[model samples]
Target: MTSCDRFLLDQPGGTLNHIRPVPAALFLAASLALTGCSQASSSEASSASEDATTSASAADFPVTIDAANGEVTLDSRPERIVSLSPSATEILFAIGAGDQVIAADEYSTYPAEAPTTDLSAYDPNVEAIAGYEPDLVVIANDTNGIVGALAKLDIPTIVNEAPATVEDGYDGVAALGMATGHVDETAEVVADMRAEVDEGLAAAPQDRLRIYHELDEKLYAASSHSFIGSVYDSLGATNVADAADKQKSGYPQLTEEAVIAADPELIVITDQVSYTADDVANRPGWENVSAVRNGNIVTVDADISSRWGPRLPQLIESIADAMASVKTPVG
Candidate 1:
C-alpha cells in the first residue's frame, strides 16, 4: 500500500509513533489524532442507482468500475448500501442516497441520519458485514483489503481511495456519485464545494503566510502533498513542515526545535487536546515563536479539518478567517 493508504487505515487511539511517519489515520477516519483506537462507525448512499431492477436494466445492472482494490461490478441498483468511510457516508447523504443506506461503519457520523453502528472499518469482520445483507459496500482501501475479503463472500465492494489534492477530492466524489447512481447530485456537490472554497480563499492575502497545521499535540504535521496541505496551498499558506528534509510521507513528525526554528506566523490546530496555546507559549525557548508571540494560534473543527469530504470548504473558510488575524510573513 502507498504511504497515503497506510495513513488512512491507522486509527487514532494510541500515542503517536514519533520514530516514523505515523499514519494519523485517526485524523482521516475520525476527527482527532488523540484517539488511538481504530473504531468503525456508520453508512450512507447516493442517488445514482435508482429503483431499477436487475432484469429491467441488465446493461446497467452490472455497472463495472475500477477502484482502489480492483474493478467492482454492481449487479443492480443497491437497495441496502454499507459505507465504511466517513467521507463516503457524507457524499452518499449529500447525493440523496441516504434512504438506501442500511448500515454504516462507526465513524460515518455526519448527517445525523446515517446508520451509525458498531461495525468496525479498521478490523472489518466479513461475517458481521455479511449479516447486513448489503448489496453494495463502500470502503477507503487502507492497509487491509476489506474489498478482497468481501469478494470471497460473493459481496460487491467499491474502494474510494483518499485524494491527494483538492481536485483529486472532486474526482473521488464524482466516482462515488457514479457508484451510487447519483451522478448529477455529485456534480452539484462538487460545484458547490468549488464555489465555497474559491470564495473562502479569495480573501487570503497575496503575500505568503507561513503556517503550521498541528495534526495532534505530538507535533505531527501535514506536508504540502497531503489533502489538508492542498487546502493550505490554496489559501497561499506556506507549510513550515515542508521545509524539513526528513519528511518523506505527507504526514511528518517535526522536532520541537525544527518548529521553533521555522517560526511560523500562523498555527492552525486541528484537534482539541490537553495541550493548548498556553502550552505552546510555555515551551522552553518557544516563547519567541511568531504564532505564539502574536497570539495567532487557532483551533479549527477537528472533524471537518481532518476529513477531505463535503466540509472541505468549511475548513478552508475557517482557516481563511484565522489567517485574517495574522500579518503577512516578512523575510
Candidate 2:
C-alpha cells in the first residue's frame, strides 16, 4: 500500500505542494468539539471540570515554550498529551512521555502502544481531537492550519518542524523532552543517538561511493539537505542528487537520463513496497547504471528511514550495513 499522504493539501490547480515528510493531524479543534459534549453529559462535564481545575492549579507552570506556534504558555504538566506528528510521538515516548500521551494521529504506528486515532494530521478535525481531553498537543508539521486552529481554541501546542540535519533531530528531541519534563532523559537519548551516528561513521568505508536515494518509484530523490541524505552522508555515501545537473526541491525529481549519466555506485530505494532489487535492475536503461549492474540497490523500510526520531540509529546502521555489503563496482 502507498504510504498515507502526510500533510500536503491540494491547491486550486492539479499541482501538489509537498508539505513536511511526516504525519497527518492537528488537534486543537478536537478540544473545541469536546466543549459541546461536556455541557450535555455529566461524566464529560466532570472530566472537563477536573481539567479546568488542573489548569487552574498550575503545577510548576506556566512554562513558556518557543515553538512553531510561537510562544505557548502551559499552565501545568500535561496529563493528556496528544501527538499529531509521528516523529514527535516517537521523541515523546523516547523521553518517557509515552504514559502521558493519550492519543496520536493515524500515522504514529511505532512503539506499538501509541494511542493511534483516526485523526488525520493533514485534515485534522478539531472536535474529534478535543474529545480526547488533551492538555497539550505536539505537531511535527503544521502545514494544514493546525497551529492557527489550536491557537483559536486556546490549546497548548508544540510545533516540531522536520529535521534537516542530525543536529536538528537532537534539538527536536531535546525540545520535546523539555515539554514533557523529561529533560535529562532527552539529553541521554540525544547523546546515545549521536554516539550511534558517530560509530556508524567511524565504521563507514573510507572511500567515497556515489549513491542515489529513491524517494519514490517515480525517480524522486533526496538531496544532501534532506534527513535521509544526512544518514547517507554519515555512512560516507556521496549523494548524486547533491551533484545533480538540474536543481529542484530538496526532494528533487530526476529524469532517467540524468540518473543514468550520474552512474551512482549504490541506489538506496526507500519505497520498497513498490520496487525490488530486480525490479529496479530491470528498468529500461538502469542496466547500464553501476548499481544495477553490480546489484547494489538496497531497499529499506520506509517507516524507519523516513521518520526522524529515536530510530535514527537504526537508520544509520542500516545504511552503513548496505554500504559495507555492496560489491565494488567493476570498471
Candidate 3:
C-alpha cells in the first residue's frame, strides 16, 4: 500500500505498504499485488483430504476462495497462521481466531496478545516467515514474490489485500473467518459493525460539514473516494480535497493555499503527523479558516485512520465526537 493518506502504497498489507509509484497505481496496485499466487501444494491437499475422513465431509474439506491474489483452496483449517498484513491481523483476532494465529508482523499492535515479531511487513523475510512453519500465510501485498517462495515449500497462502471500500472491509472479515474456521463469530462482528456504524453516523450534522483529512505533515489529503474518506461520506460530510483530486486518485497532495481556500469546517490530522493542532491554526494563511478559528481540528490515530479493520466503529465514533462539537456551525 503506498501512502494514500497513510502511505499505504505498496503497503501491500497491515495498513500501508504502498507501492511507491504514480498516484493512479495506489488503488490498482493494492488489488493487483496479491493476485496470481493462490495455489495449494500436494502435501496440503493430501492433508486436507485426510482430515475430511476423521470427522467432517467434503463440503468443509476443500474450500475454495477467490481472495485478493487469486483463487486459493484450503484443504483443512489453518492451524499455524502468519499474518503479514496489519489489517489482516486485526481481523484474525476479532473474528475469534486469535488462538490460531501463531505469529504476526510487528505492526500488529492491537489486542496486546498478538505475537508481533521483528518481521517487517514491507520487507518480509521469507526464511524468517518459514521459521514459523505456518500452515497458512496471509499478506496484503505480494512483496518480493514471497507467495511463490512459500508455495515452493508446500505452504498455502491467502492474500488478504487491504480494503478499498466499506463493503470490502466486511468481505475481508467474513473471508478470514472462513479461512480460520470462525464463520459464526464473523457474522456477529459484521452485524455489530453495521449497526454501530449506522447509529454513529446518524448523529452527524444533516447540513453536511466540509471536512479535511490530513494524511501527513506534507499536506497530502484523503479524497472523498478514499476508504478513510468513506467514513466522512457516511456521515454526509463534504471532502474539501475532492475538488483538488484532479486525477480522482483518491489521495492527493495539496498546496497550503488550496487547503485554506477550501476553508473546511473540520480538519482531521493523523496522529503520525508532527504538526500539532496549534501549529495548524497558527499557519499564516489559516488564521481565518473556519476549522482553525473555531477549534474544529481533530487529531486522529494514524493506524486506526488508515486501516479498514475491526476497529472501524472507533473511527465512526471519533468522527461523531468531532461532529458533536459542531453544535451549530463553526464556519
* 323: Cα error in model 2, Å: 0.8
- Between candidates 2 and 3, the one scoring higher on TM-score is 3
Model 2: worst 10 consecutive residues (lDDT sum): 9-18
Where model 1 places Cα greater than 4 Å from the true spot, the runs are: 1-59, 245-247, 327-331
7-119 per-residue lDDT for model 1 (tens digits): 35320111221111111121122211113222334321111112211111223444555566665666567889998888888888987788889999887788899999998
lDDT for residue 69 in candidate 3, whole number 0-100: 71
Best by lDDT: 3
What local distance difference test score does each model get?
Answer: 0.68, 0.68, 0.72
Q: What is the Å distance of residue 113 in model 2 from its true position?
A: 1.1
Model 1, position 190: C-alpha lDDT score: 63
TM-score per prediction, in order, is 0.79, 0.80, 0.81
Q: Write the per-residue lDDT of candidate 3 for residues 58-109, one digit (tens) a residue.
A: 1354555567677666777788999888788888899898998999988888
Candidate number with the higher TM-score (1 or 3): 3
Task: Please give the RMSD of candidate 2 to the true structure.
Answer: 13.3
